[model samples]
Target: MAGPLTSLKVLDFSTLLPGPYATMMLADMGAEVLRVEAPDRVDLTKVMPPFDGKISTAFSYLTRSKRTLALNLKQAEAVDKVKELVRDYDIVVEQFRPGVMDRLGIGYETLKAINPRLIYCAITGYGQTGPYRDRAGHDINYLSIAGVSSHCGRADSGPPPLGIQVADVAGGSHHAVMGILAAVIERQQTGAGQFVDISMTDAAFALNAMAGAASLAGGQEQQPESALLNGGSFYDYYQTRDQRWLSIGSLEPQFSARLCDTLGLSELKSLALSQKPEDQQRLKTALKDKVAEKTLVEWQEIFADQDACVEPVLTITEAAEHPQLKARGMVIEVDRGDGVMQRQIGNPIIFGVKT
Candidate 1:
């Protein structure tokens, strides 16, 4: 039942979200991960709210399956210690601004000199060789810079701030994991490791592939909530009679036709892909009025056996307890020692071995 990454060892010097999440995934896959936290600058999540008997739930979930080592890197002895450890560790994941690791004398060049097979991944807000490299930014700033924020939310209300850190987790953590794994495979063939420079901004920009493709193909920059996928068409969330939300994603021709048939609005099917703004708005209003005639649960039952892609929107709590998610084992209980059991979201990867 050993995981695929059981043979690897990782040294993690990242704090907060991105790098920690990448190493956490490695640890979940049975890699030996040593998380090094500085005494002066502890990961802020450790002190964050919602603590369980002095353990932050955020930190507990993120740092699971990893060992911790506290060290003050301001001292030369700590730098030398890391250098010694780097010789044995297979990969190193760090989240520091550009030049910070170099200033500490533990940059990629210094570590690669000691261990040529070391896979060094550096995750930053903007990359090591950009004008904004040294600029400090969080997930929101990165998303804004990548043009992702400009296309979110309704046109009338402008772009609403996202509740989740999409740029940090998707852009940084996912990309870092991908880059490190690819480097590991490449090293086996070439017998040499390489530096992975990951920028949150760059990763977020790459996520706009569909929008970027349209722009490159002579389309204008899409406005917020004005694109088909961004809520322009009839494929959107509608409020039910009970004020609860139902999501309709009948994008395909067949699905749209089925939706029209379900609602007894065959006349509206021809207006599904209407290019005229007025027609689109009229269709949206019709769909909205139709949806408002039923409660969310009623619509859920109505679409239970259909393929129109209509679904009731669930709250965060409801989502965790969803029957489909429960069947898939997306929610799991983890022991944090001392008989402390915490509920956590399970890893999405479905390897043959147990997680």
Candidate 2:
């Protein structure tokens, strides 16, 4: 099928996750993405664990639906070749530390001059400008600096970080895609291309809009595991008898009451009367005890008829085969050569066009 971005051409100069994942999304939508990698640089995804023999599972998963070209940017001839390629591309995405591109002589200033209509996006840890712009940082450091890590984990703990790389993927990758798309739309009208500077730390801070709002209103202090949506019994995960997990999100009183009814806890139905801190604590403790009475499957069956907004947690493997996922085509099998058909998460966007 002809994809929405079939006419778009992208030149990607990024290693690792953020930039590659962003371009992967575009490639899945039919954009022609060419990834530029260093010839001798090791694919970190292959070096990391959870491998399948010599195959880099991480690379295999993230790099699907795109083409790759290894080049040494330091070489003058390679730089000229890249410039020629960029002249014919619609978008250029690079994820290097600030000034790295300038030093390589392929920065936005140089590229935009070559291709006036080229949309250039730069993704970095701190951003193109700031006091910490040149400072090195990772996902954890970005989250910490953005005040996001402060709201994670239990009150007694030292604010444990989230398992996923929120700043890198959400802030960096997804944000870059959004910026590029917006720039593309604007370019269509004005016939002028511009630069997109995306900061992982700044993006992390942007994700905490709700928490920032709460702090601004003085509704509550942003404490670890203390926020309304962060910890409270009404909106958290619980363990069942079989050690399986279930997540509850009945923040509304009506939904909480429905959950209580589903659990046959008439005595504690009053617990859903208010969302006060003490009330939430009591409700959470009561629900934890009640949920522990049965296996996750039992609760799933019990709440099948209620609007309690509860769902059993599924592992990555189970999630891939979930009925809803299958129905929505959330996973797809792709042939990756070597007589292997690998399964990867499919594109989430559903275009009107059929393939």
Q: lDDT tens string, model 2, 58-128?
A: 88877788888988999998899889998899999998899999999999999989999999999999999
After superposition on all C-alphas, the RMSD of every candidate to the true structure, in Å, is 1.8, 1.8
Which 10-residue window in model 1 sums to the lowest lDDT?
346-355
The residue-by-residue lDDT of candidate 1 on 122-171, one tens digit each, is: 99999989689889999999999999888888889987788788889999
CA lDDT scores, all candidates in order: 0.90, 0.87
TM-score for each candidate, following the candidate numbering: 0.96, 0.95
Clashes of each: 0, 0
lDDT of 1 at 116: 98
Native-referenced Cα lDDT, model 1: 0.90
Q: After TM-score superposition, what is the CA distance of residue 315 in candidate 2 from its true location, in Å?
A: 0.7
Residue 352, candidate 2: Cα error in Å is: 2.6
Give every collision pair in model 2.
none
Give the candidate number with the greatest lDDT.
Answer: 1
